[model samples]
Target: MADLLTPGLILAAAATFLFAGLVKGVTGMGLPTFAMAVLGSLVSPAAAAALLIVPSFVTNLWQLLAGPAFAGLARRLWPMMAGIVAGTFAGASLLASGDTGASTAALGATLVAYAAWSLLGRQPRAPARLERWASPIVGLATGLVTGATGVFVVPAVPYLQALDLEKDDLVQALGLSFTVSTLALAGALAVRGAYQVGDLAVSTFAVLPALAGMWLGQEIRRRVSPAAFRRWFLVGLLLLGAEMLLRPLF
Candidate 1:
């Protein structure tokens, strides 16, 4: 892993984070997923995960705070958040074990499933009664996936969507969920001894570009059609996921 951090690679990573941030700015999500997907192709999934900590955390924290109903949302989502932290801790070693091949495959598979779900416009419903039991389960599953593959938008996002939240509420919920996932993943990396000092510095510096791109993306969102951009984004994720899924064969 030490040998992996060349200057050129670091530069590329900064640029990637910028683009990922842009995507999130436009859509309110996808920063982690897009960055991890592209960076996993350039670096190991574990390394990519390390790079994401600061930028993802900052952006998501902002998103989480921008909503009007923070206290209520947190109260409602506590069970799920706790489950995510516990499950992430449990499965952390899978990602930190230097098993790049398996981690990449897992990530690719996750991206594919998410993209397909979005593209197909499938919105599974979960009643209010189901939230008590379902939230924790979804969080645990999402955390396990995050710990394994450095991506955290599987069953959790879909499950949240299933609850039929209003548009503003849904965006804030995603921010809250992702913020928790980022923190948990960071903890997992620390416990696994995968978060190196130098990587932390780079991750911090990368935040600048990420924020810049996000600002630009917000401007574009005001002018461009977000629905069209999201369509293209999903398509790109689908293709990227397919490539990674077949990477071992090639």
Candidate 2:
């Protein structure tokens, strides 16, 4: 922990976590996306992943404990969870084997494309019969992306939106998805012996800033109109997509 306490690094990490949390709290997603984009610029991919683990866990802990929605989410999303677990394992193995730059690039491009689709593409509604299968497919794709790039929302958000869930339920859905993906990614990092005590300590320290940001974002959300929220969400998606696309270039 002391090793990571350098003033400059600590300050930067705190700022990054704060920004990420604000995005997630207001938007109900983007914590991982924002964290990885900013932190990855400063640390190795594995280190960035490790540093996010604890903060992500802390952020989701509130959602998991605050609601009764998990059961309904589970019932509606079991197949998706199964697929995510499987895909997460596959992605983790790839990371554990060695370098994951290629995987990261691929995942980033996929995220950019998906973000575009969500903003502009007309998605077909899931058939009544196919609704049962939607979760698994979404889960698998999200898991793969989560494992490879720590960016899972890109795949999960559209599907959840298409379900026409109430805002609270959608929040719960995202919270659940993030919770599962975080655990899977942690396990994968463990298997690859990528777990670093210092990283976890730093990540834990980051939680203070994250929570603070979330509180502020919630306050901001109260003042924003629904249409404004939608516009900002699109803007955020475009910026994040551009960030992902330009990541490997630097």
lDDT of each: 0.89, 0.73
Q: What is the clash count for each candidate, in the order shown? A: 0, 2
TM-score of each: 0.96, 0.85
Q: lDDT tens digits, residues 159-218, model 2?
A: 877787777887787787778888888887877787666667667888999998888778
Candidate with top lDDT is 1
lDDT of 1 by residue, 125-162 (tens): 99999899999999999999999988989988899899
lDDT at 67, model 1: 88
After superposing candidate 1 on the true structure, give the runs of residues whose Cα lies further than 4 Å from its correct spot. Answer: 1-3
Please identify model 2 stretches exceeding 4 Å from their true place. Answer: 1-6, 94-100, 225-250
In model 1, the Cα lDDT at residue 87 comes to 87
Clashing pairs in 2: 80-135, 80-136
